[model samples]
Target: MTRFPSQTPHGEISEVFSDVFFVTGSVDMMPGFRISRSMTILRDGDILTLISPVRLSEAGLKGLDVLGRVENIVKLGSYHLGAHNGLDNPFYVDRYGAKLWALAGMEHKGGLSTDHILKAGGDMPTRDLSLFVYESSKMPEAMFVLNREDGVVIAADSLQNWSEVDEFFSEAAANAMTKGGFIRPANIGPEWKRHCAPAPAEFEKVSKLPFRHLLPSHGTPLLNTAKTDLVQTFSHQFS
Candidate 1:
């Protein structure tokens, strides 16, 4: 078993909406820069469901304990399931990669694997949560909709909203991301488009979803006017 790197301390948890919380962490993506990573926590009744969870320290867990018991852990897409810390609950993922897990090597490091495979338009066990799979991308990705206040769309790498490069980025990484169109607010991630090659029609369908808040794994959350912003962003990229 490959020993994973120790969990680094992510910043304080901030509320994104009434029942949604977000935490920012750092990931070594670009050679010299530590890219920003966002994780979403949703409160349902007395249970707390984590979406694309980053490794939280003991203090972080205690902070989360105040919200509710961490009952369900979900990986929205193939790329964001690396922080599973041996929780016995079933881990969820879309059924796009059966033969080969996209990031199995990383999964091994975290001792986590997907046990529950969600399908497009399928119902997740969690109440008021629905999953939609994106078929056009070369890599299988899914976007989840939470029917909380004003509705929220929890996405993975498929959708990003980097208003500006955060301080975590090195100058080189910031410049490259800015030139590649990944630093703009309410825009598609450049790396996602270049690597996933998502189809325009798929985005067109996503644009129709009834969501007002966009909580993504890679960037800032758009609290209001999320639908309009996403439609315009998709139109600019696909139209």
Candidate 2:
């Protein structure tokens, strides 16, 4: 019985803003084809909420313990529900006795262990976080806006900022993603866009959200210029 998909290589947790931390990791898409992904952790007092989780090493877990207790594990996107790569929602739930908050329609994916259903205007992990659902996407997808630190967005697969292929990306994956248009800056997720086909109006509304920075699950964090950069993408994507 695999306690979790053999722990993959991931970076140490980094405090991007106050108690908001970020970590980078890789997901083996196939043999010799691994791509980079990320996770965001938010701490409010002694409680911590993990969004788009990635399994960490034993030392990394100790570092996480130093931050706070893992109280809530949130899954914002319906597509990546531990189905591919290392989402690690169930492992954290079993290990920490944490609640899993997942999108309403994702249960069919199996193995989700959904303790709470995530929906617009429903219960959130923290008061400072607000949910923004893509109401028209083929699959359930959403983002969170942290009310503090000039507003930081915690995104899943919809928004991305993969400016370049970093070390986490295997050369095979890098070349493949680059050809598929997955390697770009401040861009809509090419795979998500092609599969989900979310309506243009969804992004139109996203551009208006009061967020300055975006910490996406699939790319480098877009700081300060997130809104400005995304607005450009929306103009091109939705105009």
lDDT of 2 by residue, 48-85 (tens): 99998888988999999999999998888876523572
Sequence-dependent TM-score of model 1: 0.82
Report lDDT (Cα) of residue 102, candidate 2: 75
Number of the top candidate by lDDT? 2
Best by TM-score: 2
Query: Each prediction's Cα lDDT score?
Result: 0.68, 0.84
Error of 2 at 166 (Å): 1.1
What's the distance in Å from true for residue 217, model 2?
0.1
Worst 10 residues of 2 by lDDT: 78-87
